[model samples]
Target chain A: MSQLKTKHLLGIKNLDREDIELIFQTAANFKEVINRPIKKVPSLRDVTVANVFFENSTRTKLSFELAEKRLSADVINFSASGSSVKKGETLLDTVNNILAMKVDMVVMRHSSPGAPHFLAKHIDANIINAGDGTHEHPTQALLDSFSIQETCGQVEGKKVVIVGDILHSRVALSNIFALQTLGAEVMVCGPATLLPKHIRELGVKVETDIKKALEWCDVANILRIQLERQQMKYFPSLREYSNYFGVNKQLLDSLKKEITIMHPGPINRGVEITSDVADSDHSIILQQVENGVAIRMAVLYLLAGVT
Target chain B: MQKRLLFDSPLLKVTISRLCQQLIEVHGDFSQSVIIGMQPRGIYLAERIKEELESLVAKDIHLGYLDTTFHRDDFRRRDEPITPSQTKIPFLIENKNVILVDDVLFTGRTVRAALDAMNTFGRPAKVELLVLIDRLYSRHIPVEANYVGRKVNTIQSQKVLVELDEKQKEDHIWLITKEE
Candidate 1:
């Protein structure tokens, strides 16, 4: 059997180019189901998936929930807010209790990084890291890869500049790894304090000016300026972050017509991205969200096959 | 559970080999001809046929499985449908002869629906239906098996079933009367 048969999807770096290619090929085979009216498969009918969400989300949770349903698997949602997890239920206790339920897979989105690794090491079922703290969100990266593949004929040799708070964005970290794997040269541009200390080692050039980053890139992925990053002493204020590193209409003008825009959702609207640029034709943020269901469907189908 | 016999016994090796030789002889040099199996038994039939053809030639043959459950008009009423098997037709089937393989030919509704579902994948040059047992009873749809293994003239009350060993315990065929 292929390594994919028993693999736990924890991050983008865990997958090689061959694995990504296999996933793309598998996703291509499933292209028909998405176009069909029924939009379901028997591949995962007998399987059960548990969506353990500890964060507030509409798009991510719904996409994952719909992905499980689309793959014909029984889906169960668990939120720490309403569940016993709110009352001092440890992560291990929660996972162990769910493990007792005999679920085949756990698609988890936790605010703490390395929690998925902890779960996969302990649980028998396969674990998929949806979004873990400000560390890595593998599925978002995959969907972004799918979206990039759709817009550009291929990701190879394309200059993709990711702009905004890099130190506190999991989507930024994941997207950088994914874009580079698909053969894109990535450039991260943001304020000095918001950027990583060792940004160059992360496989991309770092630019302080957003306009310069736009001029040197074909695709611009402007990350959300997570309001929570304000409390971390990364930057002085959101207004300063917006004024220095925000992707406004002026910087959007700096981008050539061929340059595209991408963002891993819940945009700050006027913070990291202005209202005009967020609603601009270059924005593939909504497309990324729509593709989330389809991409997650593909992941569930493949991972559930292994399960 | 109700386990009804569909066909007499597993098809003899000689019979399957002969069928393979015949397919090779009819469709000479299996390049453009593709076999699409209608699950869950047609898949095995297609595999056996492809193995025979591969022994005769040295080319990469594309094989696909199409589950006709969702295509049936009685889709919602079928309790719960399984996720259809992967259809691995990497190349578009614009001008290829799509030989659809199935195990039993009863009401012909399955083949009729299979054809309807195949159109969504791509337009094939031609479509030919193959069946292990061609039961000439309950012809609700105008589907005729072009390639038939056995044509049993049975009453509508009787039933025929086929089982393959690829993913099952035993390979056999049996016939039985309706339980009701």
Candidate 2:
């Protein structure tokens, strides 16, 4: 008897081709269900899923809430704006209280990377890492893989460059690992201030040179810089960052017309990338957002053991 | 784009009919046996098989309904279903050949979930599978059905649709040529 089940999806590194396929299959079913007259399943009726957003999130938190509700799971959202986390309550204390309420699962997003993992050890409820600092957004990576598989056909042998804020983007870390695992040539490029020193340990080539990275890739996944978290005196200026690393029209023209551009939004337009580049025909960023729902639906169902 | 059927000249319906004959011979022992279809298309194929088997078998066999929406691998990515349809098995599947049925074999997640779904009901003596079309594509899991209706090699992006009059009011197998 193999211990092959998805009670918790903490990271993308834990997933294999089998796990990815399971997620894709689960999303495909829900995709069909949403097209019907009635889009709901009684599979998880009365099950409570606590959404702990210790940090700010728009698309991801709603996606998880929508996913949970679709499977008939009751959802309770806890955002930092009006939560005890801002009151300096310990993360463990808050989580333990949620556990005390007997929540079935905890879909958490925190400013710290290890937040979800920390909750996983402390709570009996399933812990799904919504987004944890700059560490890794596993589900985002998984959904991006699903979108790539759905649209681009395969992940293997595709030249995929992740441009912009590599230092503060969790999606970049997770996507790079997943893409390379599926046999894609991975490249990372950004301003020296935003890009990390060494990602080569993960077998990815780091390039401060943006034009060359774009030219050598089939897909360019743009990363958004965290505006609120940008410390003073780290980088020269936002305008300076935009001129060098931001994917403006001039930079976009360097790539082949067929090449696809992606961004894990809410994009800091004119800062890390231009508005035209983010909304161009080459951009699959919107597709990624749409597929986010389907992919997350797949993730929740798989982890919940729906089938 | 010139539309053409890449499969062998033999019709899919005829292939499914022949596969039915083979299944009747192999699992002819109707005792403790059940055929649960993986909805929404597999149910139609199973219904047809049930009709065919009723005429041949001496004993009345058990026909079960399975909607795998609840048993899917990705529940977080899509809109939720309001009432996940019931999984009704009239008779016990103890020490029986539980032949799971489906339309297409793509990434093997459906089959994977089916295996997981089976355990929730009861432990079966044996689990066999009969697929209408085996679209040879990327498979993440090592899963194969006991019986196959047709084997059509296709690209990863091809849309494989198995329509039934019961649901779509259209009965045919069609592949979508993806627009790049």
Candidate 3:
């Protein structure tokens, strides 16, 4: 239990309950480190990390970079838009070039599913999946769970309902694995077309009614409707989707108990959740962002011990 | 393996009292001074020392716990994974005399890491080291302690164990050696 069970954090599916707990424990320490007057440590001073993003990202990319820098590790960022990735260069070729520069780890976000998994099989360095298509965003899910544990004292036996475009979200998939592993009850509530056909096989309760879902859960994690990923309209319109599934302040106020609200951002404000609910005291959206850095720091630090 | 008692309970008590007397003489009233205990093992010794010092001076003293796991030199080079403890410094160390406390000072690496970790709080007016047991001739670094309870000559592969009981009567320091 001193080190991670796996060398790389490919996804939540690859991690067990103990691994998640270890990350949370380690992240707790890093949380203190980040809050200090001098919010930096030299644990990874000699190690170099390369953030290779094949897809566009804002928060995840920035969070990973900030986490790497806070650990005092050397960081090199690469996005597909400006890099040689646009000129017909392959994923392995780009990563191999970065590895050639003595990178010890790679934090990657790719548009294709299992890209990090593929790179892990070929590369010698550690791989952390930032986000891979609709596959899994391991760190995001870890941070979400960590935030839940921080707010609720623990994730065990808590009911968490994820409401949004579940079919196209890497966040929902990873969250289901992570929350379930930590002994939380999970439910996915969205339009029937937005939910995968076999999502019930994953052991989460499916509820299409947002009201019923909110009433049954202790926490409601609202997700954005990703228009970029949608090839065709899964729902009739954004207004229709929000009317049905969006978690508003009025909806939360009507609940028997005040359930914690969460959203993994680039939030389409007023779409998945209204401005009032997003800024409400019940929401932990900002805490989730802050915890992301610590969680990533813990992941990098723990994985660094393996090699 | 063999265990040899270095300091029994009575001797340990006398040593702690003597260390407190020396600290009192130098930093009268301890107005501008603070005590920090290194994490994991050093905290118990630090707590005992702080309690004893408070009772002697009849004044409150600032004490903090610092964990240097993130500043260690052997981070990726160590055989075992390094787990971090809590660093809870409620008061500022800026322009204050800071005394770093640890039970055993071995290769001087932990102290070195502690010094580095202390800088994150604020620059101290003066920094000093206090150790209950100093393993002489074994330091990998050039750092030395300002206050030493006892110095014992030791070789590699030997271990020094400090067991401090809550009630103080069962406290013991042992030198563990491998049997040939």
Model 2 Cα lDDT, one tens digit per residue, A133-232: 8898987887787777777888878888998878878999999878877778898888777777777788888888878888887888888877776775
Give the candidate number with the greatest TM-score.
3
lDDT of 3 by residue, B46-159 (tens): 898899999999999999999999999998887767878989999999999999999999999999999999999999999999999999999999999999999999888899
The DockQ value obtained for model 2 is 0.06
Considering every candidate listed, which one attains the maximal DockQ?
A: 3
- Fill in the DockQ of model 1: 0.08
Better of 1 and 2 by lDDT: 1
Overall lDDT per candidate, in order of appearance: 0.77, 0.75, 0.94
Model 3 chain A: weakest 10-residue lDDT segment is A1-10
List the candidates ranked by TM-score, beginning with the highest. 3, 1, 2
Chain B vs. true chain B: TM-score per candidate: 0.83, 0.85, 0.98
Q: How close is candidate 1 to the true structure, as a TM-score?
A: 0.68
For B1-180, candidate 2 gives per-residue lDDT tens digits of 323353332465466568767877887766667899876667777887776677667567788876765656555444432234445565677678898988788889878877766665667899998987787756888887789877877788777765466543346677766677
Candidate 2 CAPRI assessment class: incorrect
Off by over 4 Å in 3: none
TM-score, per-candidate, Cα-based: 0.68, 0.66, 0.98
- lDDT by residue for model 1 (A5-122), tens: 3458899888877767666655654555665644665556677899998877777888889878876789888988889987888998998899789888899989899999999888
Model 1, range B43-111, lDDT digits (tens) per residue? 888887788678777666778888664455543234332344455445556689888988888998888
